[model samples]
Target: MKHIDVKEIISSKEFIGQEITICGWVRTSRNSKSVAFVEVNDGTSLKNVQVVVEKGESDYKEPRVGMALKVTGTVVEGRNNTVEINAVPEGITVLGDAPTDYPLQKKGHTLEFLRTIPHLRGRTNTFNAVWRVRSVLAAAIHEYFQTHNYVYVNTPLITGSDCEGAGEMFQVTTIGYSNDYKNEEDYYTNDFFGRKAGLSVSGQLEGEMAATAMGKIYTFGPSFRAENSNTPKHLAEFWHVEPEVAFAELNDVIEIAEDMLKHVIRTLLDKCPDEVAFFDAHFEKGLRARLEELISHDFGRVTYTEAIELLKNSGENFVYPVEWGCDLQTEHERYLSEKVFKKAVFVTDYPKEIKSFYMKQNPDGKTVAAVDLLVPGVGEIIGGSEREADYDKLIAAMNERNMNLDLYSDYLDLRKFGTVPHGGFGLGFERLIMYTTGMANIRDVILFPRTVGSIR
Candidate 1:
């Protein structure tokens, strides 16, 4: 049995009249007086290969719409299509019988319903597009780094420090529940290690070391956040693309991040035109045009001070009133990106009070050289700032924030070891995918979105 993948059939025109064996899951079935047609897919591509089944007192029964089958048939051109592999199947063997309760059916189903069955959602066209586009984006990220002489590094997922300083963390525990519970007073700890351990929030701290030594390095992996926000953007566990560069300031980091995004957008638009067309028509009405505009236009750069001033002057009703001391809300971010900038913009130099401790303090003693890259539809796709290279100031800031400086001793030593002014920002991978694919929710972009209520 010679097997040719359906995807190969896309370019292999000579196999039209040849007998070939195709093994795939049945997508849909249609029966006529003397023949039945079944559309099948083998994860080769989105388009299902059509199989013709004729009832000629043949022993092999027609396969079900969701059943797995191996069919030996001859390809022939059929009606209303080109490259038709019309098959009068000589043998049809069932590989796996699907239960009637299979969530994915021929009939159209809602994305909300598909969320309940993450195991089978990839069979749908939308998810296939989303997942494939995500893969393409990841590849583009790696390619962009390689071209720029940035070394790819994998950082550990389990750690003892919180990079963001946000009070959201999930503990990394052992399989055993052997914790000494004395009146539930002590924190849970397994006998595996004496001290408490938890999942890493961001891989930035580790990547910083690699970058310090290697000059340029990027950490791309899963980052866990126990944030309970039920918004479309928040996810419990998501992927982060953090690139740390030595001797680079906030402005350079912002430029690199912007360039990286434009690179990815252009790559996706060029590499996956069919998928882009699909998304542009359905999810993002003018996605292709928006991406083209981004690649060509210079991003708007404004200080956080300026962004706040714009918000104040816009006369827009913001639920969270914008002020220098307060953090920017999603609404405020959207207003700036969507209305004020009208394109991807960088809001830089935020108040030190609202930012992380390690951010480099400006000469004014108020704002740090932090910048967030915000796009038209999505707000705050990237957040980064220059590091405080002054040892005294770094230690003082950490102490002021009441953080355990002892844990960040290595990080402090970088400043002590004659460190230059450096900066890096984290690009949320799912969020980036949302921006590129015109996906509205972060949930749909991720394969199995770990949210507040979902671990499945």
Candidate 2:
């Protein structure tokens, strides 16, 4: 009577004996003189439903793998009450045909090869599981924040100020090619918006603005970077989850981040058992055990100075030299989490010169109140710090760096009017997905990855 999906029929036991219309792409089919068996998947889950069709019972267009079909059938029960459909040949319709040259058939494909066909990769079982898990992960993030009374803030994409102050931003311009820029600095002053603007590298600054007013706010949106890195972990564009909390210090934000991560991992285990199991078997062995271990114990916390000492004392030779003021490389981060802590660890109190200007300077005057969360497999999953609340101190820090004064007047106004001790951390959405799914490359988790010299 009504159209239903393959998942519904497979899940609902009462659907047996009812007449239903099912539409999906054929995964595999076998034809015979008396009967034809077809496996169909509707992208609802990792599993597929089986359909039985008798020859000459009605109009039966021979089905092929990758072909779209509409089949009217009566539900039947197979062994162990497995729900199946018996197609009425007269009601069958071949919606779309796939040629023999179909790129994807019933075979294994390398992840490298799949990247070339981004549009059609979803048809594969691996990608189907990846995207479905990604959907659930995103919902988990929103659910975790919303239930915690954090207001959702939509930060602007085009920003005039560089939040990280590293200047890795994609410029937005409307100047026509007909007019050559005699002065690069003068071009932006005369272009659209009447000033320089670029895609935001981080929504932390804007999120902080909302947090000062809303008390607790989170921003989940797309962020861009102009860095030309070709590493497997880097992306030109990615999704970021940032939560800013007013009246919260560095330790406060660290607690929130740990709780949020555990909550999402627990939710994923509860919701997507099959998808998680699939990845555990294929991508990462002992994946569930790793996440369970993470939630069961408290994450180890240590100072950046302490981490450097441990690394330096170790006998292993590192490619990059480790010093007190130097940044921690990915290899060093992984070593701390995997070998030293054997779980997720939070390294705190980084050198002030290496951190951003917004981070609050510590009483020691050498380091800032910044923390980086590193996991066993992934190097650095999050970076956050307690913001500098004093107006005079912020101005001094900015002036020391010779930052553009005109671009951050509004930001400074926030501190001038009403400022509170606030702190926040940013989580790369793709990196989390990769860690959860045991996906090695960052590009595999993203649907259409944008990296150095690659747009399509």
Candidate 3:
């Protein structure tokens, strides 16, 4: 008989009384004098299937938690309206034996402890639910873009330009720590690419190039940063979802961001019911309601200046005091979304001094046409801006920043050759997962999270 997944065997009653085979890792096992109860999970579902073994069975062996087993059995109606498997005679085989020293036990393990054993943590309830939701959310993102007539583009992982201008990029070098060169320029000349190259911090630049031609494009891939901050919200490597649209302005991309996020939330709530319920029950109470509330109403909108005024007058004791031209901190952002607006809010037209050089300069001569989407639980979930389409303005902005004009000649060429008011936004995929699943740490949502001094 074909091996049926534990998820299928437990979810439906069609397999009752039918002989079948199943393979999975033991979650928990209880052995009495005459019978043994083994709960097994194949990572297909949040719940497990109970495998009952009789003491007289020839091949019956006491299965331990974390042990991989293959069992041929007959599905039967279990107690309390559930389905279980009754192992047949000589039908139990141990594929892999986890000894008594197995790290995972029936007892609860803290998230910090699980990080040390990233390899085995996926078998746990929390990680299994997180990964399952992650898979569904990834697919939902693709579905949303594809159905909306957006072209999916793959930007290069390695690039010669820093998209965010922060200079926090991981250098991709062929040379080791050897003083085998004359100068900074000469050192890179002998290296691969014959110039400075690093893992991309954002795909927005290449994504803009694709958008100008393809009309609408988005890139979903891994992004790297070399920041040294050790925080629950920060990561060295994370997935980025960026969408660029031609003939679009700051307001247009803001609408796209809101609609795309709502669609993704609806998809998650509909498809991953069990996983969401588990997260809601354990991780964050009312997580499901929070998601529903987001989709129920329109996001609030305010200018950066207006937001600053609101914060200054709100009389809330803020850790970082609110002021004009100063970038809004998480406290301020959460206050606007959670306390003031009570929903997702868009703060737009920030001062050009604090914003990137690529953003379009507004008529006021002080602020850029930039916007950040702040949600209730997570602040600044999405950041985007209208590109500076005028060649002179872009050149002036680059020159003011003392940027290397030679490196960005290709990106500059896009403006010179019929640029049409293009714009885009980037969504940190892990941040979205953290908001949806209520997983507090950025480390927990990602598989094998690469954080400060932690690669394993």
Candidate 4:
């Protein structure tokens, strides 16, 4: 009596008529005078298997929703052209019982309520589909980089310098609220790392070092930002996918980013058809068509100046006014990608002042070789820039920003020694999942979302 998976039994015809053992949590149950019908899901598939128990069956009990059950049964062609399990006498075994207080019921529940119980949300259809697509997309990311000969680098979680220069980091410390320190410097000196250290906001800095040595490298790991934003798009902790390429210009990385995204979309469409359909039918209509459209068309490309001009000329009322120097907001980004381009667009050559300190300064003196990939619905999907390879310019930029150069001495060493033209981009893994699954909130995609004022 081999235990068969619900997914296998539902997807294959070979399992029909064969006596098999299956174990899963009961999703739904209905009982009559002589027969009991229980729908069981094993987490292997979104669909549940129907287990029919006849009267006078040995150890047979009316299964309740959320109860764990093991049963031996013969598969038979059931109603509506589907297969079902006919439980043998005395074959039903209750592994675990669910109390009446079980939160999950047959009735529909809102996403808000599901967030309160992150532990049991996986059993629900919506979350089960979301997690399945997340797994496939994660694997697709690794596949894209590995096939391109990029070395996967595991960047450190704790760091001494802020990569984004935002100063919004969750500080890592051994001393907790101890008033024994003399001053700011002396306080840090007494701490574990002997200096200020915090969770990394981005892995691009160290990824550049690996890229310089290995020619190409990528990092996929947890990144933390301690911003007090309670928006759907912001998260205190999230996963980041960054790939750094040596001897590559801004345009080179843009092409790579486009190709990699198309590959991921195509892979997801192929591997997770059922889950994709689920999202399309429930979450967002035309979701499948949107994904197909992205892979079918070449992404649009425009300079930052050109994009701003397009926005300004369109005459659409925008909350944030379009300006050459100001950063593009989500509204402006969506207008460019969704309304104007009708596809993914790469906006390049942003004003240097608005971007980070490491970007290469263009010859125009006002802009850096930075690029952002914007798609419909989602504003900025990927952002990267050609790093300032020149040591003098790198130092000048850091000085202009009034940064403490000593903290980034090792990062500066990369520019000083054997520096080559290099560039890379970061893709917020959750954002990508949100885009693919049509999940409105970032919390719905991640298993345990860490946001402002909420650790659970």
Backbone collision count in every prediction? 1, 4, 0, 1
* Candidate 2: tens digits of C-alpha lDDT, residues 1-456: 346878888988888888888888888888888888998888997888888887775556678789988888889997776888987577677888999888887578899999999998898888899999899999999999999999999999999999989899998988855366677677877889878899999999889889989999999999999998998899999999999999999999899999999999999999989899999999999998888898898999999999999999987699999989999999999999999999899999999889998999899989989999999988899999999998888888888788987788877777888788999999999999999999989999999999998999
> Which 10 residues in a row give candidate 4 its minimum summed lDDT?
55-64
lDDT digits (tens) for residues 1-456 of candidate 3: 458888898789999999999998999999887888989998999999998887773645677889998899899999999999998437788889998989997568999999999999999999999999999999999999999999999999999999878899999999967787879989899898999999999999999899989999999999999999999999999999999999999989999999999999999999999999999999999999999999899999999999999999999999997789899999999999999999999999999999999999999999999999999998999999999999999999999999999989999999989889989999999999999999999999999899988887
lDDT of each: 0.83, 0.90, 0.93, 0.93
TM-score, cand. 2: 0.96
Cα deviation of 258, candidate 3, in Å: 0.7
Q: Which one wins by lDDT: 1 or 4?
A: 4
Expressed as tens digits, the lDDT of each residue in 295-391 for candidate 4 is: 8999999999999899999999999888778899999999999999999999999999999999999999999999999999898999999999999
In model 1, residue pairs whose N, Cα or C atoms come closer than 3 Å (at least 3 residues apart or on different chains), thus clashing, are 76-86
Q: How far does residue 51 in candidate 1 sit from its true spot (Å)? A: 2.0
- Clashing residue pairs, candidate 4? 58-90
| Candidate achieving higher TM-score, 2 or 3 | 3
Candidate number with the higher lDDT (2 or 3): 3
Say which prediction, candidate 1 or candidate 3, comes out ahead on lDDT.
Answer: 3
